[model samples]
Every structure is written in C-alpha cells, then in structure tokens.
Target chain A: MALSASTLKVGDTYEEQVVEDLKRTQLVQYAGASGDYNPVHTDEVFVTKVAGYPTVFAHGMLSMGMTGKMLTNYVGDGRLTQYGVRFTRQVWPGDSLTAKATVKAIRQEEGGHIVDLDVSTVNQDGVEVVSGYASARVDP
Target chain B: MMLEIDPKAKQGVQLGPVTVTAEDIQSFAEAMGDLNPLYTDVEAARAAGYPDVIAPPMFCMRMRGGRMLPEVPLPSGFMSLNAGQEIEFHDEIIAGQTYTITSRVADVYEKTGRSGPMEIIVRESTFTDAEGRTIVTIRERQIVRSPEKKI
Candidate 1:
C-alpha cells in the first residue's frame, strides 16, 4: 500500500536488507542485463593484474538497484517520481547490505500528495555504501 | 600521467532506438534480485494502470552503456570505477515502447581524497520514447585512480 500523507510523519522510516553475501556471478548477471560490459566489474584478471584493484567489485548501480527495491516496496508501484544516489563506498563480494528510507517531508504538489525521503544503504559493518534521496507520490 | 579525452567525445552521441520487451524488463528485474510483480506480471502491471509490464525506476540505467565517447587513455596502470549517479524519472518505462538514448561526457575534473589524487568523468544520458517524450535523465560520475607504488 502507498503511504498515506495524512498519517505519515517526517521521521517515519522504512528499511530492508537488500543483499547478503553479494556474489561475483550476480555482478556478471547485472553486466549482461544492463549492457555494461566493463571489465573492472567482472574480469578478475583484468581488474587485479592490469587495473590493480584487489578484486572484482559490485557495480554502483547494482547497489542502487537493490536499494531501489526497498524504496519501491515502501512507496508502492508506479509511485516514484525522483531517485538519485552517490556511491559513497565500494561494495565487495561477500558484503551484505541494508537499505533505509526516512521520510523527510509529506506535502502536496500539483494537486497530489508527495513524500520526500532520505535514502541510505549501509554495508554489514555499518559503513554507508550509497547515499541519496527519493520522492514518491502518496495517498492523502 | 594525465588522460586525454577527445573533444568530440564530449558531444552527445546517440545509442539506440531499441524496443523495450517484457523479457528485457523481466531479466533486468531478476538480475537485480527485485521480484516486484509489476516488473514481471502483465496482469498485475495493467491493474496498476500501466499499459504493460513496467520496468523498475532504474531500468534506464541499462541503456547507459555502449559508450558515448571513445576511451580516454589513462595512466598505464590506472582503473576507472563508477563513482555515483543522479537520475530523474519523468515517466514509467513501459514495455512495448521504443526508446532512444543519447549520452555525452558532461565534464572531467580532478580531486584529492584520502586515497590521493583522482580524475572524475561526468557522463549524462537522456532516454526518450519513440514519441520523443523524455523518460529519464541520468548523470553518472566515474573515478580514475592509479594504484600506489611500493618503494
């Protein structure tokens, strides 16, 4: 159900564990689906021997995409109007993530109720992986 | 060493007029581990008022590849990583609609963080439907860093 602005408060929040033990194969799946064939995301040899990273890492969009499931679940389908994020930290294989959304405002726009949210996703150790905001339509 | 990006690469380069298919939406949603019915069930999506199964909000990101610019030559041992993204959704991406994507290198700069100096590339892409209506806009930042040398 969509959130009801009449009953929603600015501090209301929703959270979810988006991913657990993120797998490298999942990154390959994302690369195929997203059409982003960047070697750094999947080719372990290239990423480590050539690019010099410790190992293959998760795509930032993957983190955002998983986090978005949390947002859409909270706001309801077809309700989101705006969503954006910054990759604050790298997400690695075996990392688990929790996404959170705190209501920042409940107001009306263009004759409809809207909810603004502060969006954040943190790794198992509590380090933020992605940080951003989102706005969605709500019921009055 | 500094990287050199071709001036022409900064201009908007068109990518596709690919049609969105139910399979595409389903695969993408499945890949992200999002089991939202609206993304996979046509009946559920229609009940929600969309003409067909709708893609998730970040679906536009798939079109972000097929590089808009030629690769910049980085230091021999440096790596480029996605730093962030800002997306604005004006409409839901419904299956059966054809969309075109145009991406450009918006900017390039440098900054120093705890890891030392890094180069940032900002790329912007716009997704428009067959009717030329803007569906979404995505601005992405990529960071280039070289590994530290051990003496």
Candidate 2:
C-alpha cells in the first residue's frame, strides 16, 4: 500500500514516553554492541571518580536512536526517507527522555509527497539533548 | 601535541553489502520500545500506503561490523565521539533488499575548547539498493579527543 501524503498535515504532533531503566539497559547494550566502553556510559565509578559526573551516562547515539524510533512510529514504515541529528548534551542513566516530532512543511516532488519534520529528544528537565529534521514520502 | 590535518582532505570509502529485512526493522523498533503500527502492523502500513514494512530513519546506523575505524588512517590514542549527522533519503526500503554502502572520509579539522584541542572528522556514506538505485546519503561527524584528558 502506498501512503497518501494528503492525510498528513502541518501542526501534527507525536509524542512518546521513555523509561529511565530501559534507557540504562539500552545504553549498556549499545556499549557492548558498538564496542564503545567509555566509562561515562558504563562505569558509574569511573564516571564519578574520573569524569566527575553524577552517574553513568547514556550514549549519545542511544538518544538519537530513541528519536528515530519516534519518527518511524509516527510516520509508519517505509515512509521515512531521510533522518539526521546533532547531539547537544549528555543524557545520564536515570534521565527521562521524551521524543517529539512536529510537521514543518509538505512539498510535492518527483511524483511523491514530501513531508518535512522537526524532531527532538528532551530530558526530564526539558533540555533538548538531540535536535534534527527528517523528510519522508507518502501517498497523496 | 599539536595535530595538523587538512579539513579538505577526504576520500570516499564503502561500508556494506548488507541485506535489510523486516525482521531487522522489527527488532530495532522493539528494542527501542516503539509500537508504532507503521513499523509493525502490515495492515496498518498498507493502510498508510507504504509498499512494505519500512525501516526507521536511523536504521542504517545499526549496520555494523563491515569496517573497522582503526583500519582507517586516524590519529592514535584518540577516542571518537559522534558529534552530528545529516541524512537525505531518496527511496523507500523494502524487506529482504540487499544494499551496498560506499563511504568516504569527507573532512578533518581541529577546534580548541575549554577541555583542549579536538579533532573533528566527517564521513559520508551512500546506500545503493540491490538494483543499483541510490537509497540514501548520510554524512556523520565524529570528534576525536586526545586521550591525555580523562574526561
């Protein structure tokens, strides 16, 4: 089935809840999978003693991954055409992250509907840790 | 130690002949605890008008193990940190499609911060579908910090 781009509109908003413990485990798993054993992510003691952080921090990619999840869920599969982001701050293990996406604009090109989106992940204190935009094609 | 690199010095490099499947997309969605029907339910996806179950936007980020960073000519004792990324999508991905990635070292530069001097390197990856259609282009920047600083 092809998605109709006409159904999506500007001002559409999507939100997701992020659990802290799940974030911690995901961070550890990412470390193991990516071989990024940075102490700031996996070692609380090292983070405290060496880096002076309050606790173990989540990997920046992990946060970005969470944002990607938000977009896929909102737009539906196969519709996502492009995604990117910038890491703004560190996410600690216990921090609650919220992912949000808002429709910014819609354009038609090459026989397809293109939707531009503003996406972001904000921590519990409301600081955006990751920010970027995504574009996708849908049936119109 | 002061390190010098030409910000304009860069070359294209290839990363994958990876096969993307619905299972991989599902796993990634599940791993992230996202239940968006667009990523899971085929009926919903169809109703939404996608040709098939599509992957998450950042799905390519998980395509690992094809290349080793150390194999590239990078400075020693410096840890790499993902700084930013920009991606442009060209086509929708279907399950069971094979892809070949061509990547290149795009640039290298230096920036001084309160912590010290940081080296920033950019890598660009182009994903081509099995039929040779270009699917996406990803530009990623990574910061390599001198190991002398513990942080």
Candidate 3:
C-alpha cells in the first residue's frame, strides 16, 4: 500500500538493512546485469595491482540500487518520481549496509499528494556510504 | 591537474535501442537482491495496473552500457571513483519496450578537498522509449583522485 499523506508527517522514519556482508560475486552479477564491467568493482587483481585498491569494491550504483529497494518498499511500486544520491565512501566486500529514509515533507502537487524523503545508507560501522533525496507519490 | 582528458571527448553518444526484456528486469532485480514481485511477476505487475513487469526506479542506470564515465586518461597513479548521482524518473521502464540512451558530458571541473586536488566529471544521460517519451534522466559525478590522496 502507498503511504497515506493524511498520517505521514515530517521526521517520520523508516530503515532497512539493504545488504549484509556484501559479496564480490554479487558485484560480478551487477556488472553483468548493468553492463558496467568496470574491473575495479569485480576484478580483485586489477583493483589491487593496477587500481591500487585493497581489493574489489562494490559499485556505487549497486549501493544505490539496494537502497532503492528500501525506498520502493516504503512508498509503493512505481510511485517514485525522483531518486538521487551521492556515493559518500567506498563500499568493500563484507560491509553490511543499512539504509534509512526520513520523511521531510508531505504536500500536494499538481497531480496529487507526494512525500519528500531524506535518504541515507550507512555501513556496519555507521559510516554513511550513500546520501541523497527521493520524492514519491502518496495516497491521500 | 591530476588528469588529462581528450579535448574533444565524445558526448551525446547514442548508446542503444535495445528492447527491454523480462529476463533483463529479473536479473537486475536479482543482482540487487530485490525480489519485489512488481519487477519479477508479470501477473502481479498487471494487477498493479502496469502493462508488464516494471524495472526498478534505479534500473535506468544500466542504460549506460558500461559507459558511465568519460574515457579520459588518468594521470599516472590516478584512479576514478564515483562521487554522486542525481536521477529523475518521468515514467516506469516497462518490459517488452525498446529504449535508447543518449549520454553527454555535461560539465567538467576541478575541486580541492582535504585530501588534495581532484577533478569531477559530470555526465548526463537520458533514456527514452520507442514513443520518444523520456523515461529517466541521470546526472553522474565521477571523481579523479591522485594516488597520494587518501580516503
């Protein structure tokens, strides 16, 4: 069900563990699905030797995708109008992530009511990995 | 400058008119670990008033075809990292429909942070369907960082 704007209010929050112990294989899967075969995300040897990173890391878009699951679940299917994020830090394998969305506003638009949300995803250590905003249509 | 880019980097490159498929939608949602039926089950999607299964909101990011960043030459020991992204969705990407993507280098600039000087390249990509209606627009930021810079 879509969130009802009648009861929605600013400062209301929802959170979910988007991923736990993020895996390299999942990165490979994302590469195949997204057609973003950047070696830095899936090739450990290249990322460590050539890219000079500790090991393969998750794609920023992957984190955004997972975080998006949380958003869609909160608002409802096909309700999002806009979703944007800044990749704050590198997400490494084995890092669990928790995504949270806090209601910023509930207002009326030309078509109907909408909810504005402040989105944030943080690693297990509480280091934020993705920060951004999303807007979605809501039920009146 | 930490890096050098081709003065005439290609922009507004038309990427694809690939048809969206149920397999593509399913794989993408699986990779992201989202089992939402609206993206996987056509019957469920139809119940929701969609013609077919719909791609997740961020699925438009995949339309880039591994061309998310400008093909600039990084200086020795410099690496590129994703800095941020902004996406606006005009409509849901429905399965069985063909879509084309056009990407352009919107801007390039330099900024110095606590670590050191870095260059940020902003790329904007638009996804449109067969009807020539816009589906989504994304602005992505990629940061070129020098080797000495520590995160």
Candidate 4:
C-alpha cells in the first residue's frame, strides 16, 4: 500500500536488506551494466597497485541503487520525485549491506502530500556507507 | 574561496546516444538483487500495463556516459571522489529505447573539512529520447582532495 501523509507518522521507519556476502562479480555486472569501466571498481591488481585500494570495491552507485530499491519497493517505481545520497565510505566486497529509510516529516506542499525521508545504507559492521535525504509524492 | 576549475554554461555536452536493451535492463536489475518482474519478466510487465519489461528506477545509473564527469581537467594532485548525487525521474526509461545524454559542470567550490581542504564539483546530466522528450536529470557532486597526510 502507498503511504500517505495521513497514515505516515514522523517517526515511522522502513528497512530493506540489499545484499548479503556481496560478491565481486556483482561489481563486474554493475560495471557492465553501468559502463563505468573505472579500474578501482573492477581490477583488483589495478586497484591494489595503481589506485592504492586494498581490493576491488563496489561502486558507490551500487549502494545508492540498492538504497533506491528500498524506496521504489515501498513507494513503487516512477513515483519518486527526488532520490539522492552522499558516498560516505567505500563498500568493499563481502560486506552485507542494509538500507534504512526513516520518515523525517510529512508535509502538504503544492496540493500534494509529500514524504520526507532520512535515508542511509550501512554495512554489517554498522558503518554508514551512504546517507542523505529523499522526497516523494505519496498517495492520500 | 575561488574555484580552481571554473564552471561554464554548457547547453548540452553529448555523452551518449546508447541503446537500452532488455538484457541491459535485466542485468542491472539482477546486479541490484531486485527480483521485480517489471524489470525482468515480459509477461509480468505486460500484465502490469507496461509496453514491455521496464527498468528499475536507478537503472539510470547504467545508462552510458553519466560517468564522464571526472574526465574534466582539475587542479593537479587532486583526487576525486563521488561525493553526492541528485536525480529526478521525468519519464520512465523503457528497455529497447535509444536515448542521448549530455552533461556540464554546474559549479565548483572549496570547503575546509576535518580532512583539511577539498574541492566540490557539481554537474548536471540530462537524458532525453530521440524525440527530445525528458527522460531523467542527474545532478552529481564530486569531491576532490589530496591524500590525507598520515600523522
């Protein structure tokens, strides 16, 4: 069901698990899909030797996309007006990721009921990888 | 502080006229660990009223050329990071469609942080159908800085 301002409370929380024991090929798949051939995300040797990273890591966009899934699954695809995030930390392989979306506020704006969200993605160790805000028009 | 790399008014810097295929859509959905039929199954999509299998919302990240921003010239010794992003979906990007993308440097500014100093570059990329209808607009922020000195 679509969440609306009437039904949405300020402190309501939503959570989704995006990945578990994340894989290396998933990054390859993401690289193939996104056309981001940045070696830091794909080549372990390049990352270790050239880029100085310990190993190949997940794209920040991957975490951001998984976080977006939490929103799309709840609000339905194509209903989000704005979704954004800040890349706070590197997401390495083997990290389990969970996206947390909390209702920050509800407002009636421009004749539409909008939901404000405090969104974040955290790894298994509870390290915040990405955090930011997202807003969407909700059903009433 | 003055920006090292100044911003410009770019009407549209063509990045892609890439085609989106069903495979492209499915691969991205799979990578995100999403099992949504609308992004994968044709029959389910048709039942859901989409003309064909649709793409996930963040599939826009997969659209080619959105990553071309960091190629811009910046101050030497600066390491760039994907700091933040703001995306607005104007139209549902469907599979098997061709869209062109263009991006421009919107702003550049410096901020002093705990790590010392950094430059933030802002960019706006637009995706449009061949007919030029709006598809999506992505505003991304990139942060650049020198490697932190180990004490």
Interface RMSD of 3: 1.3
Quality of candidate 4's docking, in CAPRI categories?
A: medium
Model 4 lDDT tens row, A1-140? 57777888987989988899999989998888788776778998977875576898888888898898888887776678788898888899999989988999888888888898999899999999999888888987
Superposing every Cα of model 4 onto the true structure, what RMSD results? Answer: 2.8
DockQ of each: 0.67, 0.43, 0.75, 0.62
Fnat for every candidate:
0.80, 0.46, 0.83, 0.72
Reference-based TM-score of each model:
0.92, 0.78, 0.93, 0.88
Better of 2 and 3 by TM-score: 3
Residue range B1-151, candidate 2, lDDT tens digits: 4445433334454556887777677776666566567667777777867766766665666653313232344567555567778877777655667888777666667787557788777778778998899888878877777656633
TM-score of candidate 1 against the unseen true structure: 0.92
Maximum-DockQ candidate: 3
| Model 1: how far residue A122 lies from native, Å | 1.1
* TM-scores (chain A) of the candidates: 0.98, 0.87, 0.98, 0.97
- The global C-alpha lDDT for each of the candidates, from Candidate 1 onward, is 0.86, 0.71, 0.87, 0.80
Can you write out model 4's per-residue Cα lDDT over B83-124, one digit (the tens) per residue? 779888877888777898877777778787655777777888
Candidate 4 ranges beyond 4 A from true positions:
B1-11, B64-66, B74-78, B146-151
Better of 2 and 3 by lDDT: 3
Better of 3 and 4 by DockQ: 3
What does candidate 3 score on TM? 0.93
What's the distance in Å from true for residue A36, model 1?
2.0
What is the Cα-based lDDT of residue B108 in candidate 4? 73
lDDT of 3 by residue, B32-94 (tens): 999999899999999989999999987888767665645677777776777878999889999
iRMSD values, candidates in order: 2.3, 3.3, 1.3, 2.2
Model 2 ranges off by over 4 Å: A1-12, A20-23, A32-40, A45-52, B1-9, B21-27, B35-54, B64-77, B92-95, B112-116, B147-151
Instruction: Supply candidate 4's per-residue lDDT for B89.
Output: 80
